[model samples]
Target: MATEATEIEITTIGRRTGEGHSHPVWFIREGKSTFLLPVGGRGSQWFRNLRNNPTIKLGATSAKAKLITDQAKVGQVMDEFSSKYGAADVQRYYPGVDVAVEVRDS
Candidate 1:
């Protein structure tokens, strides 16, 4: 049961370099699913990495990851983020970005 305030480390394989890249990011968990929002949007490097490989490391846990571009689903996930972090904070940190990463059992 990960709280929304919890920051988790995510590692992705670099698309070009083929190296493991790790970064700390905010997460929202619902049941067994975990969601990540890229503050930097689609152009973000980690987002690219996840695109290159759906497999990602969430701290000690390994999960399959996928980019979520559907507007409705993205909005739902954003709502979860907003609910946890507050709308103001989420807007401040994730301005103009609708992209997200969804993690589930690999």
Candidate 2:
């Protein structure tokens, strides 16, 4: 069976140093578009780097430096994220947070 994009966990890169960071982010794919939810908020380096260079290493089994971003389509992806990761407060200090990131699957 082909690997389902939904089943993959993308490993995003850091802003300053291109290091790898893994998080259980929700990914919804349509055509060539993939969406992500950065629950960590401002502390989420993945979101910072992606927004800067839009390049990341998507790692589920292996790794690939693919491009990602955020957009209106995030609402759709956030729905899936809330379903899988649940709508519970992902962060403690900041409640009711719904930050997300949109990326291209590598």
Over 4 Å off, model 1: none
Against the hidden true structure, what lDDT does model 2 obtain?
Answer: 0.52
* Reference-based TM-score of each model: 0.91, 0.54
> TM-score for model 2?
0.54
* Candidate 2, 6-38: lDDT as tens digits: 445566667677676666544655566455555
lDDT by residue (1-106, candidate 1, tens digit) is 4573568898999999999999998889877789899888788899989888877999988778978998888889889988888899999989878688889854
RMSD of each: 1.4, 4.8
The candidate that wins on lDDT is 1
Off by over 4 Å in 2: 1-7, 60-72, 83-95
